[model samples]
Target: MKDIFSTIKIQVNEKIYVKDPETSALGRKIIQESILLMEEIGFDNFTFKKLGTKINSNESSIYRYFENKHKLLLYLSSWYWSWIEYKLFFATTNVDDSFEKLKKAITVVTEKIVDDKATAHINEAVLNKIIISEYTKTFHTKEVDEENKEGYFLIYKRVINRIVKLITEVNPEYPFAKSLASTIIEGSLHQHFLRDHLKTITNCDEHVSPTDFYINLIITVLKK
Candidate 1:
């Protein structure tokens, strides 16, 4: 899967960037270094000027690829979800059992991330941290509805809908498939954040994973 993923280009919404950052050495550098920089400094403190200094390019050059840091974060967020969507599809494909397939899909989304060595420029582990920590900033804005209209969040929504389909397959009578699918996705992130920071509140620690909790919850909720 890693080899196949290395060959696949994760596409983001074109409206998110002035230029695609995956196209050139410098462009890719902006993305590669930006991820490291954002993870190091957090999104609120991240800037094109800081990225340019880290990449040894002028601030203006960064703008050639991204209009501003907000758009860059959007590109990163879209790219991360697109990659996860690929993994979710591949992980659950051709499974014969509906319940087992649903479990696999849940595992794909909830498990701890590790760096995919296939994508040299992007670190999946660090990117997952960004998604867990900073992802809300991408959409928690006044421009979100307009951006949603522009299809900026399509891939992320597609991911949840895929699991929603699997939930309905497992239990045709389950009327809350959409809500449950979204909760599993969003709640997994929140659980991970709690485990890392506010450990007392969440039961997802080293021994008990978010996957374990969600899988158990799904079984109890969907069992006939």
Candidate 2:
């Protein structure tokens, strides 16, 4: 009977031993530092040893938390989306008017993309790789089923629905506002990334700020 009791206690302790807040915090720190390193060195040149050195931990420690560099990159990508969501949430919370809220959202998002130091350091190749990898992971699968489509579409629809609601509040007569909103959101992202090269190709010396372009584009679309 005593042996049985001792075994139960040992099992409980083993389960609880895996849960450590300090270790979790340390892991998060390692992830953030890894992102900065990727930004500096570019993803191709980034290595586990460099990341481990930055975090003052062994490669084994990082592997214990994350399987590999690819997994770490995915986590960083997810973190970027979460960061954008938080910024948009905060920007919209206090605005009384829907149009104002929408304007704030556009402005905040453009400013974040354009001005983020870490984001600027990540070259186009790395960004494209990350985007393509994530897209394929979420959409492409061995079995294409309704559940997969529905799951992916849910995320897209939610974003479009939110934008459409804001647009409709400002201009009720706009036809196919939902589709237009989706186009604007996606277009702005593409435009931001391509702006620097587009200017050079066009030989336009004057600089154009992403925020101004986004604001103007939004106003033009809303008016139409």
Candidate 3:
């Protein structure tokens, strides 16, 4: 019964930020309130100037941490995937059945996020809203290749890698483990986004559980 988060660190790459937002009060406030404000206004309209105003600080102060909102988004995304990877590991660690482990991982990612008091400084539930709403923007840029080389996405890569391993465990002969794993991860989150906006386009029904469709999706493909 080890407290997994207590023993692990969510490492956002140094290249992504000028200051580690976890280090100081102002830094932590910037992260905490940034998650709040991003959820409130959406990432496209979010600005350090507005954030500074809300936090009662100078806009220039945000640069002491992030170079710009793009990098900030990446930092938030990295933290999220790190948290997710931890959760997936924690959720499935003792399961003997590979397919069951994979199902649990899918549920952890595709389902609702609950606030964990262990990391009270962060409201992961609100952060998941931003993540589901905006995570793709973190890499849909010209600099993605260079940033990839800097190891800016290792945690994200690791999550996929872990899922891929589970996929292989379930069907050692399967040739599409990586592809299927990525599809489950990205497709499930994308469906969650659609559930909020174009509910008609989504297969998930709230009364049945937000994760039901996605869990069925991966299980069907993996078991087949």
Residue-level lDDT of model 2, residues 1-224, one tens digit each, is 22332232111111112232124667556755765677677666878888889988887777766655654654454444444555566678879987788888776555524333433222334343344234334334453365344342343445556677878987898888877777655655555545544655332224665556767766887765
Worst 10 residues of 2 by lDDT: 9-18
The best candidate by TM-score is 1
Give the per-residue lDDT digits (tens) of candidate 1, residues 114-150.
Answer: 9999999999999999999999998999999999999
lDDT of 3 by residue, 1-224 (tens): 23757667678889899989989999999999999999999999999999999999999998999999999999999999989988988899889988888888878877888876677678899999898899889888898999999998889989999988988888888889899888878877787787778889766667755578767766677675
Error of 1 at 191 (Å): 0.5
RMSD of each: 0.7, 11.6, 1.6
Which lDDT value does model 2 have at 45?
80
TM agreement with the true structure for every prediction: 0.98, 0.61, 0.94
Candidate 1 lDDT trough over 10 residues, lowest sum = 1-10
**If ranked by lDDT, best first, what sequence of candidates would result?**
1, 3, 2
